[model samples]
Target: MKKYALATLISPFLFFLFTNCNKDKSNTEETPVKDTIVVKIDSVEKKPITTIDTVDYNQRMIALSNNDTTGRWPVKAPYPLPGALLPYNRIIAFYGNLYSKRMGVLGEYPKAEMIEKLQEEVAKWQAADSSVTTIPALHYIAVSAQAAPGKANRHNMRMPFKQIDTLLSWAKPINALVFLDIQVGHSTVKEEVSQLEDYLALPNVHLGIDPEFSMKNGEIPGKKIGTMSADDINDAIDILVRIVREKKLAPKILVVHRFTQGMLTNYKAIKTTPEVQIVMDMDGFGSQVLKRSTYLRYIYKEPVQFTGFKLFYKNDNWNDWKMYTPEQLLEFTPKPSYIQFQ
Candidate 1:
């Protein structure tokens, strides 16, 4: 696994001070409505049926399978509660943190440039597969794993609310969905997720957890690849389920990042519910052949509810290997419904 460099702006001293002064306040602050806009859904019939239409949802799910002959696809999960974003719309997300340009595409360029680049990717995916509607997304790393243990010695740093507000403001212009991703170093998933309850309650905001930096064994993050068990994932699902039911919001998509078989354990024990949709994302980077082999071994064979493929613009081309085009990825068995660029 490739280790991401630490943010240039987040020094140990600065992060420690920020952690003590603002962590609690940011967690407790009310979610602002000015930056959030209702996501536009395409009408199914003469009337708009974005919310309670099971028939359309089922048909879309089948379409997403891309006529898979294997029984693993379209995992027979529960019909999501109204307002699910999965099969109806394919998500094309730019992943990274606002503080680090080396982290991903989301932070590699200026705000305007980044949005434009994301739009370009969205266009490419739309052209590759016109059957599903493409939704642009900003997959921001809200809680990032840190090389140096800060404040509580958790080896994870939470981005300030101001930074999150900035990302939300950026998303408003493009009507893009925002995902708050967490890479828990020494901290538990429950602890990290509980702090983001207010943000996760929003209709357009989703959740992603990276097992690569989970650090369940108390090893320093980035020194070695970490893992998450089914119980760990179930904890996140349970929290999201409660949020959806209590807030009466639509289903929340939960993305779990994985590249190796050991990164995620007890695959059969992971639970799925109507309130949460899970995507086991292939998060490795390499040559086309290597990427396909990783996907086939871990993502395709594991039989998750939904699958996602990740492309690295720089890393994929390390040995002059070209990145997989959207068309190339679309031809795989159980075509990926979620596509991410890093």
Candidate 2:
């Protein structure tokens, strides 16, 4: 099984791809350029044409990290996982609170309009790589935040069952998967995960743990960022693993969103099992260069089962620059497999 890193960029496909990273060196090989071109006859032209190979992302990154001719710093390939989920795959997801129009596409647009927006994005990704399948998902932030705070006054709030059920119903009609994300404000992963057991039992449902609001100490979620140790992540993994085994369902996907180093602690200790797939998503929104830098610093630097990228519909589009298209994102050595739009 090969461990993979996930990279995702803005709205259109919420696309991300999988690639491996190896931090420690056990073997060495000659480095290769970021991209290699090959000539092939176009079906329509009947003439040989040169095209860049996008599928060799894993190999290209390995070459850059392990073998470098320049005296610059050399990067190391991420550790390989026993197995990964993407074979040049992509996932386009609409993320936000279904209840608040300010949150994401889910609530920003009417149901009909939102569905249309998602479908349009799907079409774009399919056009980019017809061979790969694009999964449409409703990335509902089940638990959101509030200023007044409740019960624990942790600022971490849970979405009502009614709201989640409504979104699940919408996803079902489109044959989309439902991702229930938890902020866990002033709460523990164990506690948060345990409450969602019933929903996790569903075959199409998945999980996402956001460390940004984890509040490792006693800091407020909005006041400052938080962190999650490998242990915290493992607890969520264990819960999903058990659910998958007991239900005899397909492997469950768990996405952990991150952008900064402190958002996630202890990368090496994080483990993946047969029952559950883990994706380390770079959840920051910025310009193309800034986004790429974050990917290199975290997703590539710290190897995980897979990588993911998040695109802010408005935030990423700042500075009058448009969002990154699927074709442009494929330029990365290891393409991101999971993508989310907010």
Candidate 3:
């Protein structure tokens, strides 16, 4: 009697183990694994993460599949931005420091060679895009002035207004944008922005802020450098929003650069602003390879547009340019709308 009782208990335990093992096997079969996934940005199931550097390759796959952008389905989820595409149709290239041409390498300004290099880069991208099926928007960088504390030759970037006019003339005909870059110093955001309001008035003009250069009294961001507060940024945004709406233009894109935590002031506030377009750009300017998968999955997946990038022809070679390319940034199967060429 004792031996039979023991067998009954043992049999039940064995059965449970077999069932669990089988269940796990079934799960394995149901889930597809992937190192990369490609989806169209506007299609359903895009599952775009925040940054491309941080996705885990070993994670089990769950497809977010959408065959066409026009597919409409019943859902409680709010609609994504209309006309959104996987891998955006715009290209942004930075060429900061108009007046620092004489400052040389240490000043971090692009000299004559850099200008030619950028024009070449633009031509190259244009050449590359010629054969593609979809058309992408192009914006050239035009940072205003230089600010290096009490330095004599700094912040003198009056920008000739002539250069801006020339750039504007060139961009308008080609249907490209001219992103005005700002490095706010001891001056207020409104004051600095007022200097370039004319450009913002243009339909294709966008705004870019370099917190790295927006310091006071010789401080650099991440090293006692001052940053623009949320209110400061919003003040600018308010004008932009008004301009875009009143003028009946497209939503204006605002770019805020961040290399570390402190650099970002009031991220939540900036994100929630009404009808404002914002991109939290990673302003890492070095060769140290970084892990991007985390940001892409967590942050890029949010409602706002998240960017994957690098400042090629500048720094951050620790990771290859291939990793930051529009095709590879964020492992986003659908691709990103923005790509930067330094």
Of the candidates shown, which would achieve the greatest TM-score relative to the real structure? 1
Poorly placed runs, candidate 2 (over 4 Å): 1-85
Model 2, residue 89: distance off in Å is 4.1
TM-scores, all candidates, are 0.86, 0.75, 0.57
After superposing candidate 1 on the true structure, give the runs of residues whose Cα lies further than 4 Å from its correct spot. Answer: 1-55
Candidate 3 has what TM-score? 0.57
Query: Which of 1 and 2 is the better model by lDDT?
Result: 1
Q: Which regions of candidate 3 fall more than 4 Å away from where they truly are?
A: 1-88, 97-158, 216-224, 271-275, 291-304, 318-323, 330-335
176-253 in candidate 3: lDDT tens per residue? 456666656455567656666656766557777655445656442223435666777777788787776675555566
- Full-model lDDT for every candidate: 0.77, 0.66, 0.42
lDDT of 1 by residue, 1-342 (tens): 343222111111122332344444423333244334333322121222356577877777777677877877768888887667778678999988766666788987999898999999989999888887788999988887766676677788777667776777787777788899988889989998988887787777889998878887789776677889999999999999999999887788899988777789999999989999999888867678877887788887888698898888887777788989988888887789898998
Clash number by candidate, in order: 0, 33, 32
Write candidate 2's Cα lDDT for 1-342 as tens digits.
111134423322111110012112111211123122121111111121233243464554443233434322122323222222343346788887654566667778999999989888877888876755676888987765333345456555666566667777788767677889988867789987877777777766789988877877777565566689999999998998888779765567798988777778887788667677777788866678868987878776777666677777887787776778888876654566788887
True-vs-predicted CA distance for residue 229, candidate 3, Å = 2.8
Compared with the true structure, the alpha-carbon lDDT of candidate 2 equals 0.66
Q: Cα miss at 117, model 3 (Å)?
A: 6.9
Give the candidate order by descending lDDT: 1, 2, 3
Alpha-carbon lDDT of model 3: 0.42
